[model samples]
Target: MSQYGKLMLDRYPEKMILPESSVIMASDGTVLRRIPLPETGYRIKAGLGEMPQLLIDTFIAVEDRRFYSHKGLDYQGIARALVNNTVRMGVSEGGSSITQQLARGLYLNRGQNLLRKLNEASIALTLEKQLSKDEILQLYLNQIYMGQGQYGVKSAAERYFGITDMKHLEIGQIATLAAIPKGPSIYNPVDNLELSAGRRDLVLRIMQQHKLITTEQMRAAMKGPYIPPVKDKTEIVGASYMDAAIKEAMRQTGLSRKELCAGGYTLVTGMNIEAQRAMERAFSQEEAFPPDGKNQRAEAAMVIMDQRNGEVAALLGGRNPSTGGLNRAVTPSRQPGSALKPIIDYGPALESGKYTPDSLLPDIKTTYGSYSPANLNGVYRGQVSMRVALQQSINAPAVWLLKQVGVSYARGFAVRLGMELAAEDNHLAIALGGLHSGVSPLMMAQAYTVFANGGILNKAYLVRSIRNSQNQVVYSHVAAPQQAISVRTAADMTAMLRQAVSEGTGRRARMDVTVAGKTGTTQLDLPGVPGKANRDLWFVGYTPRWTAAVWMGFDHSDPDNYMTAGSGFAAAMFSKVLSML
Candidate 1:
């Protein structure tokens, strides 16, 4: 080949490089999530051998009649197109072939001037001489811009028909895709099915007239239904989890948010896609958060962490958990009521070598410096054991137990187990969850894992790893665990919490499997109201395999009783998620 030939051939793409979106997958290689990069949908290119011959026939039959016969431009076809344009009295026919379309769309300018057209024709002829016909056709198929941010034939097929491989395209489906380039918006089946069907029938006619397809084949294709792609049914929801992954990634690596999302990175998360969808369905779907005129002001959040490894399997931040912002799982801790009793007061009290499950404690009405605590039902079983007090979630008995155990030791131990306790809260009300600063659902989840995993407090992690565009590993997961308490304490507390689930206020959380958990409902006082209100309900629990924290409350404080308004909703939601796993 001459030097000029080599230079001209160099202008053609050596290999296509598509700007792809980042994908997050589970450990098993299921696509748990896909985050669109700044401006493009995923575009994985297809080759000529993978494309169907029927689609190629329709493309050639509609776009260029003399494609194989012409070198670059068909002069006779150009004259025919010119006469047709003149008869129509509008600039319609360009008389461009497959090679010309590839040349103009990929490299040359889009202009109607004589000079621009001549340049485009020159490039087309150069490309034709340097490459095979099949190669040029492959380039054309992979470079056309189908609407809705799709780039290649494979992407277009998936976007329009939900099919991944182009070889699966039947005659009618091929005609539907073939007609899209005529006028992308007008002929796109997703936009206008009837109009797209008309354009598809035209392509079928062209194929029949050129004898590329038989009359019977054309008739059958015309009679077939033009089914568009299925509605997007991605089972996994990454909005909340992806946000957490990116923020944690930034914190670990000190990379900016813009740098993390600027493409060329894969985020491997420990979250299971199926578990995520199940949690979302139980929390966000219409059945769970029904708009049927009940508790409209109510919202909820949950977090499930693997007790063995601390991998975050699923997380739901709010009632509407899909569109993520202001995650309730991580920040803005609210009072955890009796749910805080086991982790903060009881666990530490038992861990301090002073308390026992069978130890006797007063459950009668108790008063401490003008602060008198009462049970939920207002009638307490006098002189109950520490185990009974925790299992039944009786208020007065907890305050008495806290007084006996002392506040500083319980508070310090709770902090070690990841409770963000209040500083000025030196009062005995801390026993009944009267802290100035409350604990987050995330902290509660991590702290509870100690009980589930025999006293090991493992840090909760969402992202499994992050990789650059070159598939180089940037960060990987490492288990960071600390033993917060003795196994005896964990075992005793687990027994009490298991009793709470089996026969106490947390009975709603009782599932087919053995569950150990506690229920909490904080009482609130609102202005312009006569009586007390309730908010911030929770049921933080764990099985031998999973530890989950579930919270339900109002976005804004209200006078409605959510437990009755949405009775057992929080525990039921947790149970629903557990049943799926």
Candidate 2:
């Protein structure tokens, strides 16, 4: 062998193997779904034993007849193809064998030129030398492209006939799948059924001619009914949860979606199925939301995190969301309203060592540098306690407390708690949840974990671990809790928020179990409107075991499309989810 051939043989094994689809499982080891390969769609590897004998026989008989006798390059078949093309005055016959086809699919593109064909031949010769006959055939079967974005016979079987095991396939179905590799687009059973059936009959006839199957078998298979391909419904359950898990897996592994899909990794997520279903049920109820306005329907998003390890338990981006559509739960597009008070205003004030729950904060009209913040009720009591100020969600006191705590210092503190505040947010308006960019429900839930987790901020995550196809642990999550506030401060903040839920703005969220939460609403400024019209409503809260953030609004809030309800609506929805849990 040449030195170059030896070098090529050393590198062939890594390149010859095909990518397999990654699987995603829930926390309890329940299989959630399989992520499809990047451009190739879905693929599942099949061993030689998993493939039916009929499929193997039909594929070999139609694709390569002299497979057992020929070396990598079939000189006799090549000569015959050349003569036949010359007689036809066109390229109608392919001289490349199954090994050459595999090499081209794996290492080279399908270009009908001498250079590409030469490269294919060299690689095929190397593959034949390196792998045994069955190995070569197994790789060919698993690596070949079938149709409809499927990569192998297994994926095509599951896709075209909805059959997981090849043994369940009829003889005609096996022939149809075997016929697709010749021209996947032309013989696709889903798109061109008549053409695929004709090709399947040709394969059956070829199998009979090779004496691989009897004449009676061939006739019966040809006369069988050809069912059109059905859409695979394996991903119908937990589609949105799977999408979010995939995104988190990509982020944690530093792998792109394509890489994660093709890596064959098993991602174990922290998804709580019961909590997910409860959140879904709450969001699906039309009565849970306010009546739709003339122009738009209200939308809502929620995120629930397990406080034990900061793993996201349940998430709902919106009602009836498309699988990969806009995920509002993770996108920080809407203003958080008074939800920012606990993280920025009160929490920071308590941590500053200068304030307490009973500290008398001035609720009188206050103005600083042309910025005059007002209470939502347009009435303020002078010298209200800090606890009452937070419970009523009085805006003036929050802004005043932020002024005392210093905007820069409070913003820095909120950052440590997982709120992504902007440079422009270094102002008193943040006390009222006014900002250049808003926070996502995910960010809100993560921030609230500080209070639920005894002053330690546990970052929320979805994936707990990932294992590669070889059953090797590739990535595992480690709990890293950052101290954002003192235990006393967290307890004080929780006390105030608990009162808020029991008697104040978040009273609608009170449950049988111990719950602490706050409510927030961003008012819409519309001239001639009687009362307050809200653009955004929010309720951020936590229990002993879980932290949750809920937001309600329209995607685009305008005069015609705005919220008429207050944050109590969001709090009530939260109560519904908690009840189900």
Q: Per-candidate RMSD vs. true structure?
A: 6.5, 4.6
Full-model lDDT, candidate 2: 0.85
Tens digits of lDDT, candidate 2, 1-581? 22444466576656665788998888888777777676647778888898888888788888887887887788887899889988988766769898888877887888876667777788788878878989999989988898888888998898888788888888788889989998999897887988998999998888888887789989999999876556545334466667888888887888988778887789999888888878888888999997677788899999999876899998888887767988889998888889889999999899999999999999899789989888776897887999999988888888989998898889888988987688888778888998798888999999998998889988888899999877898889998988878999999999999999998989899898988999888887877654578889999999888899999999988778888888889999889998888
Top model number, lDDT: 2
TM-scores, each model vs. reference = 0.71, 0.81
lDDT of 1 by residue, 178-296 (tens): 88888887888877889999999998888889887889999999999866666756654757777888889888778876566655468888887777778887775555641221455
**Residue 429 in candidate 2, Cα distance off native in Å:** 1.9
Alpha-carbon deviation at 78 in model 1, angstroms? 11
* lDDT of prediction 1: 0.77
Q: TM-score: which candidate is best?
A: 2
Candidate 2 clashing pairs? none
CA lDDT of each prediction against the hidden true structure: 0.77, 0.85
